[model samples]
Target: MAQIQASIEIDAPIDKVWSIVSDLDSEPKFWKGTKEVRNISKEGNTITREVTIAFKDSKCMQTVTLYPKEKIQIQFTKGVIEGTKALTLAQTGSKTRLDVIWDMKLTGMMGMFTGMIKKHIQSGSEQALESIKQEAQR
Candidate 1:
């Protein structure tokens, strides 16, 4: 599986950071790779949704579990990708540290290009975190 991780420290409180990250519907605003999101179902803090990604404009089903201000776990259950993407928050002094980790691999014939796409995913993740930090700090 290809693994990518990126993190940013926001000059804001944990709650402030969480407020921005927890809004799943607004993901496309910060995460450029995520073109769109459509909710399929929700139960408590967990939600099943279909996401249109920038990679060939492919659609993927993901199970997202929100852990309040601590973490958000996204499990890719269908489509081109298979694995997990986790967002974790840590408080340092008065600031919040947001970390994004993508542990995934492309499925089927696309699997061979996993290594080739790793850098693109990593760059997108870093850009997303930076965008999140900017929004939260504002």
Candidate 2:
């Protein structure tokens, strides 16, 4: 599996940061790789959704579980990618540290391009975190 991680410290409280990150539908605004999201089902804190990623406009099925103000776990259940992506939050005084980790591998023949894809995902994760920090600090 290929692993990628990104983190940012926002000048805001944990709740303030959580409020922004927990809004799954607004992900595309900050996450450039995620072009669109369509909810397939929701049960309490768990949501199964279809996410259209920028790579080849491919649609992936993700099971997302929100852990209040602490973390958000996303499991890629279907599509070209397979694995988990987690967003975790930590509170330090008045600042909140947000971290995103992706542990995944491309499926089938796409597995050969794992290195290239890893770079793209890593860059995208960093960009997304920066965007989130800007919104949370505002």
What lDDT score belongs to each candidate, Candidate 1 first?
Answer: 0.95, 0.95
lDDT of 2 by residue, 1-138 (tens): 998999899999999999999999999999999999999999999999999999899899999999999999999999999999999999999999999999999999989998998999999999999999999888
RMSD of each: 0.6, 0.6
TM-score of each: 0.98, 0.98
As a whole number from 0 to 100, the lDDT of residue 3 in candidate 2 is 88
Q: What is the alpha-carbon lDDT for the whole of candidate 2?
A: 0.95
Which 10-residue window in model 1 sums to the lowest lDDT? Answer: 129-138
TM-score of 2: 0.98
User: 47-119 in candidate 1: lDDT tens per residue?
Assistant: 9999999999999999999999999999999999999999999999999999999999999999998998889
